[model samples]
Structures are given as structure tokens and as C-alpha cells.
Target chain A: MSDLQARGHEDWLDDVAVYALGAMPMQDAQRVRAHIAACEICRREYALLQPAVGALAESAEAFTPGNGPIVASPELKARIMRTVRPERPGAATVPQTDAPVRRSVAPRERPILWPVYLVAAACLAIALISSISDIMLSGQLKQSQAELAQLRSRTNALASALADRQAAISDVLAAGAKHYPVDNGEVVRSGSRLYIAMYDLAAPPRGHVYQAWTLPKGSKTMAPSLTFVPDAHGVAFVSLPAGAPETSAVAVSLEPEGGSKQPTTKPLIVVPLD
Target chain B: MTEDAVVLMERVRKRDADAFEALYDAYHRLAYGLAMRMLGDASTAEDVTQAVFVKVWSSPELFRTGNFGAWIARVTRNRALDVIRSRTVRAETDLPQALPESESVEDTAFARIDRELVRSALASLPDEQRRPIEMGFFEGVTHQEIARRTSTPLGTVKTRIRSGLRKLRAQLEMTVTT
Candidate 1:
């Protein structure tokens, strides 16, 4: 009988799932790998389950930034090429209309001419100028990406401010307005215009935005208040329905920009508005 | 695409820079997705993804000619996990966990269901089964860690994960067959 058949141990079958999911403790995982390497039956089973286990990670593609996966910095390719092919590093330039670098054997005979030295000098100068331009272009690309990120952050801040203003307005309409400066900002509820002047919170990117949610007593979902953008001074306001529950907690989270029906990321602040 | 990958791998073996670029473009998203889910940080995920490609570029001989996708994926996942292990001390959270809320949306990968199908299958799973599977798969929590955090017996957690995966596999198989 084969080793796997002789062993006839079904217990390790469950471990295959844990192992494939990459959740086994190091020692147990090592043991399982060792077993699979040696046993044909176990290897086949592990192979069959491998694709499904990996599918678990792929399923999470639904949760990525709506803009799609973040592209690695443009310079990353050139940097990788330099590391991989040190002698021919310039070969790593991003797609170009120019001809590919020519690889040729060096001439053994010495050339007797001043023009050769002049040509060599010119080539070196060209290389230096090209290097400088590449660096500057890389710098420009990074700056643009940073600016785009900042714009996305501001957009999210504006969204959260709008949400908070609506929630506060609704709260005021049901009862009377309440104004209080709490910590970083002032909370004002006057008639229908409810405002929350926020302070000291930075903006988030596309996959994340600022969210204000209200948690009422004996309620499960934290009712979404608003999504908004803060001002240059980190101040913002939002107004929502004024008929909000009494003694409720107002929380803020940096969440998916499309706005999670619930908070998917960590909350930055949680305040009880009694 | 698989045939193209094989051709690219052969070209890469011969030090063809253009082929390397093509291969990197083809797989980088999948690699980044896995890394991002594992690390929970985009910058770190980018670093890990770049490093994986760089390793392949530098040492093309280490890879066999066939099955380039599987080889790169296994390498990417292992490297991402190594980074995760090094960065943070794994704290076994003993709190009861809930399924992370995300909608069934469209996305695609080789050897996996389209995004909506995968999400639908996961959503169909019972809470008891789905919770542990999500913790172990998405959060990179160990089986023992999940058991401790959920306050379930270790054996029970393993069974739930295995059963959950089997059901998902069946669901996915139906889609592929159809």
C-alpha cells in the first residue's frame, strides 16, 4: 500500500483547508507540508483544494479602491531593471519608440583618432542629460499622484460635512437647536441648518472617506449621518434629519469613499451627543 | 493569456526586457490584490508586489517554464505573509467577530470565479461558517487565533472553515461548469 493509503488518516484532511487558507500554526503547517510532499494522495487533495483556498483572496477583489488597484510608482520598473540587469540597466526604460539597446561585442583593436574620444565624450554627455531628465520626470509623476490623492481626500471631507449638516438640521427641527463647542470644533443646531465645525482631522483617499454615524440605544445599525469634506483649517459641517434619537453616540470613521452602508475601516472619533 | 505567459517566461529566461514588462503588467494586479488584502495597507502592498517581480526578474532560472501564474502567486502570497508576520505582533483577539460587510460586485481572475459569483457564494454561507473563514482568509488570522477570539473550540473552528470552503468550491464549480 502507498504511504498515504497505509496511513489512512483522515484527520489531516481538515488541516488541508487550514493550511491552504494559510492559518495553520508554523509547526503544524510545516508538518502538513512535509506530509503532503511525501504522500501522493495528500498532495493530490492539497492541489485540488489549493485553487479554492486562493479563491478566497480573489473574492476580496470586490473591496478594492473603486478606481482599481493602486499602480506601483512608475519609477518602480526602472528601479527594478537597474537591480536585475546591472550592466545593462538602461535597458529598463519604460516602453519607448526608440530602438532597443544594442548588445555587441567590444572591438579588440585600438582606434587611432581624436574623433573617437570626441564621440565617447558626446555619448557620456547624452547619458548624463538623459539621466537628469528621467529623474525630473519621476519627480513630476510623484507630485501629480500626491495631488490626486489630496483632491480625493478633500472630496471625502466635503461629503462628510454635508452628511453631518443634514443630521443636525433634522435634530434641530424635531426639538430646538443646540450649540456647543466640543473639543476641536463647535456643534451648532439652529433651525434646519445643523452645522458641525470639525477640527484636526486629515482627509482620506478614494477607498476611504469621513463618515458620521449615529448610534441610538437598543438599535443595531449606526444610522449614517453624512459624508463631507473639511475646509483648509480642518473645519466642516453637516446637517441631517433632526428627529434623531436622544442620548445617541455620534461617531466618525474613515471608510470606503463610495461610503460603506456601515463603517468598513477604523473610526477616528466617537462622541455621545446627549 | 496562459500561452502568452509561457512565451513571456521563455523570453524572460533569455533576458528579454520587453517580455518582463509584459509579464509584470499581466500579473501585477492580482499580486497587488492578494498583498493588499493580506497587509491591509496599499503602500505596503505595493512594496511587496514590486519586490516579488524584482525577485523573478533577477532570478528567472528559479522559475520553471510552465505554470507561470501559479508560481508567481505562490511566491507573492508567501512574501506578503512574511511581511505581515514581521511588521506586527499577532494579537489573538478573543472578541466575537462579524462578517465584513461588502456588496457582491464584479471582478475577475484566472482560476477563480468572477467577483460577483465569489461574493454571492460567500454571502450564502451561514454566519457560523462564514465568520471563521473570513477571519482566517481575509484577516490572515491563524486557526488557533480565530478559535481563541471567537471563543469556539479549536476543532470546531477547523471544521467550520473546511465545510465552508467545500460549499464555496461546490458553488464555484457550478458556475464554471455552466
Candidate 2:
């Protein structure tokens, strides 16, 4: 029997309830998540328990007249309406009732004229066709412009990457170049520029990236540098800002995507430059 | 006759202003109440409520399935949690990333029941059972934190929450059938 099966069904049931409530700690949650993925019994139990947890939100006492004095003011509704209907000026400024108040416009009576009706129909058709053509053309134009902008962005990124690669190569070859070996990587400093050259480093876990940090000399805290993912070969060359002259040490840690303001995990590699 | 929320949502996807207004009117109280309960401040609650509704208005597609009321409440709770996180260094809880699917007939029936009934059902639970669930649900605290606050063992707190939820589910199912 698998470890999950050995642990027994009743044992996992306790975790299913807490996991459904979203109250489990990250480590415990991960274990429960893995078990739930493998165990059909636990999955059903989780699904069964979810609605009850969801129903708990309804237990909150909403504000009503005589319930309390903490009612949501009309202004709050007005603000929401304004944001949703910005195109229609003053249309939603007034708070609405439970039912949306619709304005009904009455049709006026007029004498029937066959020729006038025919002429009007023809004019409407012509106008509609012209408007549709214009709209189609406008849409295509916008698409083209967007494509152009995207291409320009890609080119600029490529140019920047090429420049950095060239600079890194020059840094390594330049006189007075200093290198400090780290775990599967090294920190290279030439003049004021610093670069982290990593090789054979495994990809960070999903939803995570390798972030570099610099601890400036005499500073207790490490300032954030940049976040990067290695290429297909598990190789990365990242350039740090020109703060290496006064920097005491550099460190890299696996952080969530978009990076964290501070190190949230232990450093995979730390290089002391000072 | 009152329109179904799904029908109103379809109209909302087409930018039917009246339908949008009706949806807002129907669920605003729930959203505001949830935010207030979690946040404990009237002005901030109103802000959170407005943000939640505006999200529904702009991206109704984010709510793919499940009870609309339940989905909105989850959104409001998550927003309130974000506000709380901004203010303190509380350990973050992992709320579900995807929208919940309405899985069974019982889930649908429970969704249709009155909110007041759910409230009363919760109120009927013993304090030991109910308090931990509330602390975990509203406060977004971990089970460990709940244990710490109540001075109970971690295992006991988990058991009480599990027992309470099971009982709550039974009561709601009974109410729906009757």
C-alpha cells in the first residue's frame, strides 16, 4: 500500500476539512494538496466539505434598518455606479433601488407615407453599410498598430539583451577582472560593473524565480537587485547595477514570481566580494 | 418575479446596465457585510465592497461557475485579506486560485437556501466548534493561530472545525429538504 493508503482515510479527513476552510499552514496544505490529488476518496470528501465552508460567509450579519446603524451609505453605491458607467454622465449618480429603474420613451403617432418610408429605409441601409465598413477598417488599423508596437518592444528587448551579453564578455576579458566562485556560478567584477554568471543551475520551482540581492558595505540589510530565469541550458548571466565598489556581498535566493521585497528563502548562493 | 442571477449575469456580460444595477443591488449587502465583519471598519468596508462590485462589473468572466453569492463572498473576503496583509506581517493563507465548480445537487440546494438560515445554523453551533471556524474563515488566520488564541491543542481545534462543518452541512441539507 502507498503511504497515503497506509495513513488511512479517516486521518486525511481531518486535513480535508481544514484545507477546505483554507486554514492549514503552507507546508501542511502542500501535503494535503498532494494527497487530495492522488486519493479519490479525499477529493470527494473535499468537494463535500467545500459548500459548508462557503456557506459560512452568509453567517455575517448584514446591515438593515433596525439591525444596526452601520448601514452602507448611498454614496458607496453611487461610487460603484460611477466607476462602472463612466461613459454615461450622471446616469448612475443617484442610488438605485433593488430593481433597476428604466426610462420608457413613448412613440409618437405620425401619418403613414409609403414613399417617405421607402426613402428612409434606403438611407438607413446605406448609412449602416458605410458605418460597418469604417468600423472594420478601424479595427484592422488598430490591430496593425498593436502588432507594430509589439514587434518594436521585442526588438528593443533583443537589443538590450545583446548589449548586456557583449558587455559581460568584455568584462570577463578586461584587465583587473576579479572572479569569486559560488555554487555552480561565479560573480565577476570589472571596474564598476558586476555580473552573475551561473551554469548548470536547476530551474526554480513553479511560480518562482531566482532573485539576486546586494548587501552594500556597512549595511545590515540586503537591497533587492533583479529577478531572472535561466535559459534552456540552465545558464544565466545577469548584470547588477554599478554598486559593486561599495557592495560587501551578493546573494541569490528563490522567490515567488515578480520577486519579493526581501529574501523569503535561504540563499542558494552567496558571494563575498569585499 | 425575481430574475435568476445567471440570467442577470448573461445580460451583464453584454453590458446591460440595468441588469448590472440589479445584480449590484441584490448582492451589495452581502459583500458589504462580509467586508465589515472581516475589517471591522465602516469606511474601509464600503471601499472593499465597491472594489469587489467593480471587479464583477469589469471582469464578470472571472466568476466562471458555482454560486454567485458564494463567489462574491469569496472575492470580498480575499480583498479584505489583502487589506489586512498590507497592514500587518501575518502569515499568508493559501486561498484557492481557481473558481469553484458547483459539483453536486446538494451544493446547488445549499446555494439556494436563505442566508439568514445559514446564519442561524452557525449561531446554533457550540462556541468551541463555531469560534475556530470563524477565526479561520473571517480572520484568515491559520489553524495554529486559532489554537494559540483559544489555548486549545492544534489537533482539538482541527477536530472541532471538522465536526462543526459536518454539522453545519447536515443542518443546511435538512433545511433544504424540509
Candidate 3:
């Protein structure tokens, strides 16, 4: 063995393992590539290791759908095609390879079944064209469906946003209307509708209704406004009778269901409406 | 070189769309399959696959005369490994499951058989050898990282990987020769 080969042979073989896996560091890879160029043994070993390293990647094929090949998306093709220029016939000259070109075979004589062959070829051309068209149309349909779904989702979002905005506007406009803040609640008078909004107002116990009452000035009997139960969130909206009562006080009291004509219990809230 | 592949590549160099399309049809699945295996996510695998093809389309000259399948696999693996390395996810033992089989036909008979052989070889590996090798190639984990993560000594990890590779090399070489 040459002195250089004797010294570097073992080390270079070790590097071959890393080289095969493409895991050799860039600096080391340069050294290894150079060594392989000079050493026939290293080159053969490196070449042999390549197929194995490649098989490591090829093994992944089994995990794919059907343990077989996957087709590229039509959109991907379209995108690639955008940047790809079709060869203008004879635009660029191809450099010849080292491999020898095989001689072209002589044309064979036509069989007696020329008509049948022609008919088969025509049928095949039609079938091939039809299949390609079908594939393109299917891809387009899927793209359209996806777009439609996205549009529908966006439309629904817009509708929800619109609803939220309208609700906010209603709240802002209600702020302008006469508002009477009662205990843990507020009475809002907008046009003929009187909205009672309560916060932290627990729902009445069983067999009870939260009754609204209007106590007119200088009146012994309290006039009933509305009756309803607050929701689980401890919030309720009740519309009182149309037309505001001047010189009166609004009140809420827990009463028996089918609300009492007059509040039979202590008022939970009372707000004066001048 | 396979005759069909040589023809397709020549046409691709000439920027022939039909030829390029034919090549894409033939190899996209295997490319995507390798990406999926490395990245462990279908959508990301798809992106990597697209990137690999785009790369090939952009630089058709990179393809050598022979070994089209091997070239595609190498490109796909490298790109997928890049994606995996960029991810914040640490390599773990729980690999992704294979997807449900699709009805698509095999692109070429040779690729199908080659894939089967590789899969068999991989499956035959012991867990110790397989795990480290996968982490190195698929997750782009360094030998040191694999050693640390698996609690194996650095030397042990290296030996296991080298030994595993030797076995694989023998199996693959036999397939090619015979």
C-alpha cells in the first residue's frame, strides 16, 4: 500500500459512513470528496453506500397512500408551468453525454390488420383526451367548492359582525333615551318601549316571578309594569307598558307567578321617573 | 438509466411541458412519500414535495443521465429534512402513522418494487438501529443529539448507525446487482 493510502484509509472509510448519509459537515464533506477522488477503494465504498442511504429515503414510500406513487396537484403543475418556458423547437443545444447512442430500429412492415390498428389508435386517443379533461374538470370543481366554502364562512362572519354592530347601536341610542338606574338594574325608556336591564340580579326562586311595577305619584296601588325571569347569566330585558308615566317611580319585586296585580313583596329596586 | 426517464429528462431539458408532466406524474408520489416520512405531516410534506419539483424544474441540468429515482429521493429527503430541522418539535419515538391507501396506480413497476424492498429492509431493522437512523435522517438530529436523547453513549450511537447502514448497503447493493 502507498504511504498516504496506509495512513488515511481507515479514517476515510469512517468518513464514508457519514458521507453516505449526507450527514457529513460541509468542511469535512469537502475533504472526504477530495479523498474519494484520489482513493479508488474509498470511491467504491462511497458508491456502494449511496444506494443504501437512498433506500433509507425510499423506505418512506411504503407509508404513502396505497404504499404507491402520489400524483402532483394540477394547481401545482399550473404554478410550475407559469415559470417554465416550453422549449421553442431547437432553442437550446443539448450537450452530448458519454453514453453511446443506440441505432434506430428499421421500420417494420404493416400487418394485414392495418385498419383495425388505426381504429384502435383513434379510440385510444379519444379515451386519453377524455380522461385528461375529466381530471381537469374534477380539479376545478374541487377548487370551486373550496372557494365557495370560504365565501360562505366569510359571509356568515360578516352577518355576525353586522348583528353585533346593530346591537351596539341600539345600546348607544338607548343611552340617549331617558335612563333610570335602579338598584342593581336600570330602566331605559326608548320611544314606547321601556327596557329593564339587570346586572347581578339572580333569578327568583321556584314559584316566583320578578314583577315590574310603576308607582304613580300620590297613588296607593302600585301599577304593574312587566313580569319575567332573569336568565342564568343573571341578566334580563323586560319591556314595560307603552307610554311613559310622568311623576312615577319604577320598581321590581319578586312575586308569585301570574304576577300579583300589586307587588306583594318588598321591592328589590326602585327608580324615580320625573 | 431507464429509457422512459432518459427521454423525459431530455425533453424536460428542452422545456417540453408534456415530457415534464410525464415525469411529474411518474415521481411526485414517491417524492411526496419521502417528504411525508421525514416531515411527519401531510400538508408540510406536500409543500416540501412541491418545493422539490420546483427545484428540479428550475434546474433541470442538476439531473444526471442515470439514476432518476435516486436523484428524486435524495432531493426530496434533503428538502424534507430542512423542513424538519426548521420545526421546533423535538424528535420523539412516536412516529406518524401511514395514511390510508389511495387508489392511485404505481408510477412505474421498478419504483414500486424498489420501494417495497426498501420498506422491507427498514422493517427488518431492530428498534435501536432504526430509531437512531430515522432521527438522524428524518429529524436531522446530530449523532450527539441522538445519543443524548436516547441516553445511549455517543460511540454506541455511531456504531449502531454504521452497522445499520452496512446492512442496508449490502441489501440494496444485492437488489441492484441481482
Candidate 4:
């Protein structure tokens, strides 16, 4: 890399750490590691950096929820399956996966639809409440009630349909179905590769649009990998910003709130990375 | 892992009836356990756990693979996180109330030492650095959430967390070496 005693010492330590953590860019990382082999001070510094990274990982390995019991419903699965099934099938199939239970419940892999729905509900309520006063209510109530009765019948039919779903789900779960695990190597899986950054988003070449992107690791680079108009999840899962690794780093930038060639502001958060 | 429950997931993707039920039975307990871990309250865990699996059914395609157990775990975890996030918990903070039952004494002791040391080092950080780091890593506060709670500039919040990690590493390194 450089003569062992030659490089300036001030920036040298940061280099050692960047190397140790593998946080440095590839070429620079090679240079730092090469120097570490000969330089005792850097070597010692590298040793120190090791557990610090682990402790950070341990802390980051959640960094929340602590070492506590994850509360769960005794009959939640039945409830979920009930919600989906149209009719219960007579036959049950078996689910098999290479990984076991430990890989099953790591936190981030779960569907966010529940909370997202809750958020949507709150938003809907806000939207409805704001607009409710404008509704003309004279004879509408009576008419609405008639419709409500029909809806309830429909709901009942749906319930029966759902009940069949429940039975099928019950047959499938049957008290120990294997879970499908999405391992993002962290408690959260922000998915990888181009997801939301699809170019099909480039349509309607007209109005002022919004934008999105996969960001640089550790909030560095000040550039994004891809950009798009996100769906409700605020997901613009682009080709995982090329060199991005699974570390708690990333921030989403808002660009014209529709679409932009580059990041218009700093970012919303160190996304998917966080 | 061919529990009758596992089969439902296969059907679940293609919109099967019986397979979903079988899958539900197989991994329901673990999902509950995970909810318990994230949420702590039995009731809250229960609510979130049910919601997790239910969501699985409606949007089965979102679940990209056959790893139903892990998928459930991931889903369970996400549900628990949301429940914890939106609901303001009034916890009677019990710092290190007891040694976890499953851990051996030696492992626990070493863990405790590391935890304490980490805590001490964290405490030494400037408030700016400590807040984001603790919130992000310790409290699981997402970067957006931290910025919102603190009312700090967004970029500044990021810098503080990044710099905070650098400093935290530096200090912890010093302590162990000394």
C-alpha cells in the first residue's frame, strides 16, 4: 500500500477502523488492510475495532424490543387464515423449508399490512371526518339503512366464505406449519435489488411528479441508486444501491415529491437500511 | 417440517384453502412467542399476532417464498413493532430486573459486563450523539422517528448517529484495552 512508517498518522486511525469494519470502499479497504499487516499501531486499533463492531451489532440486532418476551395471540393464525380463505379445501398440504424455526421469526420479515392498515384507517378517519360535515343527511339515513341490511347479508355470506377459508387454513397450519423466512441478515428485511425503482414509473411525461431512491450505506455518498413514485408503503425497492450491504444505513430523499433525476433534499430517513 | 400446516402456505400463494389452515396451525405458537418478545404485553401480543397472520392471507403474494415459518416470524415481528410504535407504552422501566432464566450464570455475567460497559460508554457521549444512537440501536427508533421525536434537523440527526457510532466504537475500544 504505502511505506509502513510513511503515511500521515492522523488520518491513519480512521483508515484502520474503516478497514476493520469493512466500511471503507473496496480499493481503500485493500490499502488499509495491507498497511495493518505491517503497522503495529493500526493492528492494535484493528483489534479494538472488532468487539466494538460486535457490540454495535448486538445493539443493532434489534436495538429495541430488548431481551423480552414477544407477545402473541393464541388464536391469531386462525383469525388471519379466516380473513383470506374463500372456502376450506378438504385436503391439507405440507410446507417444507431448509431453515428451521429460529430463522422464522426475526421481526422484520413479517407483513406490515396490519400496522399499515391501522395507519390507513387513521388516515381514512381523518379524511372522512374532515369531509363528513358536508354530507346531506335528510332522507339519506333511511335509504342507507336499507343498503346496510343488504350489506350485512352480503357480509354474512362473506363470513361463510371466510369460514371455509378458516377451516382450510386450520388444516394447513394444523398446529405447526413451517414459516417462510425472508432473511435480510437483520431484524428487518427491506428487500433487495430493484423493486420500486421500476422505469415504467417514467410514464405520463407531463405533470410535476415525485421521486425515490436506494441510498448509500451509512448515509454517505449523498446520492441514491434509483428513484420512483412509491406505493403506500413508501417502498421504492430499487436495485439495492449497488454496493449497499446490510448495515443500518440509508436515507430516502424527496424529489419534487413525484419524480426527479436526483435527490432533491437530504432524505426522509436512512431507509430500508435502517 | 412437513407439518400439515406447512402445506397451506403453498396453497396460500396460489390462493389455496386447506393449505393456509394447515400452515396456520404449525407456526402459530412461535408467532405468538415473537409477538410476546416484541410487545411484552400478553394482550397486545395477541392482538398483533392475529393481525400478522391475517395480513398474510390477504396479501400472500407479498410473501415471496415458501419459507412460511420465517415469513411468519418476519411478519410477526413487523406486527409487534407497529403495535409498539403506534401505541405509547407507559412502561415501569425495570432496568435489568432479573437475569434471563435460560442463560447460564457465566454467559449472563459476561453479557451483563458487556452491557454495562456499553451503557457506560454510551452515557459518556454528547447528548446529540447519544440520543440518535440510543434511539436507533438501543430503542429501535427508526431514523425518521428519531428526527421527529427530537425535532432535530434530519441531516444533522444522521450525522450525529453516524458520528456517534464512530465515537462509541472509539470509547468502547479504549475501555476494553485498558
Give candidate 2 misplaced runs (Cα > 4 Å).
A1-8, A63-70, A89-274, B1-3, B92-106
Ranking by lDDT: 2, 3, 1, 4
Q: For residues A1-274, what per-residue lDDT tens digits would candidate 3 score against the true structure?
A: 7988575566557566665565554444444543443344665676566556655766776675564555446676576565564456666576666899877999998876668889999999999999999999999999999999999999999978655433432432332466666655567765544556664578788999899888766776688867898765455656566356553677889999889987788898877777
Interface RMSD of each: 12.7, 8.0, 14.1, 14.9
DockQ of each: 0.17, 0.27, 0.15, 0.13
Which candidate number would show the highest lDDT if scored against the true structure? 2
Cα deviation of A68 in candidate 2 (Å)?
A: 1.6
TM-score of 4: 0.32
**Which parts of model 3 are misplaced by more than 4 Å?**
A1-8, A64-74, A85-274, B88-113, B173-178
Per-prediction TM-score: 0.50, 0.55, 0.48, 0.32
Tell me the tens digit of each residue's lDDT in model 1 across A50-120. Answer: 56665665566556666564556667667766665577646745666678787798878986677778989
Q: How do the residues A1-274 of candidate 4 rate in per-residue lDDT, one tens digit apiece?
A: 4665354553566555434332333334434443443344555665554334334422222222566533234455555655775445764465556777454556666565656778989999998876775465635876899899999999999978655433332222222322111211011122332222211123323443344344455554455444445333222222233443533443445565345656666654444542
TM-score, model 2 to reference: 0.55
lDDT of residue A246 for candidate 3: 50
RMSD of each: 23.9, 20.3, 27.6, 21.8
List residue ranges in candidate 4 displaced over 4 A.
A1-274, B2-7, B89-139, B142-178
Model 4: DockQ score: 0.13
Model 2 Cα lDDT, one tens digit per residue, A1-274: 7887666666678878888787887556645644453344666787677788777777774434356744689998888888777767667757879997888988988977779889999999999999999999999999999999999999999978755654555454343567777655678787887888775679989999999999988899999989998766566777898467889898999999999999999999888886
Ranking by DockQ: 2, 1, 3, 4
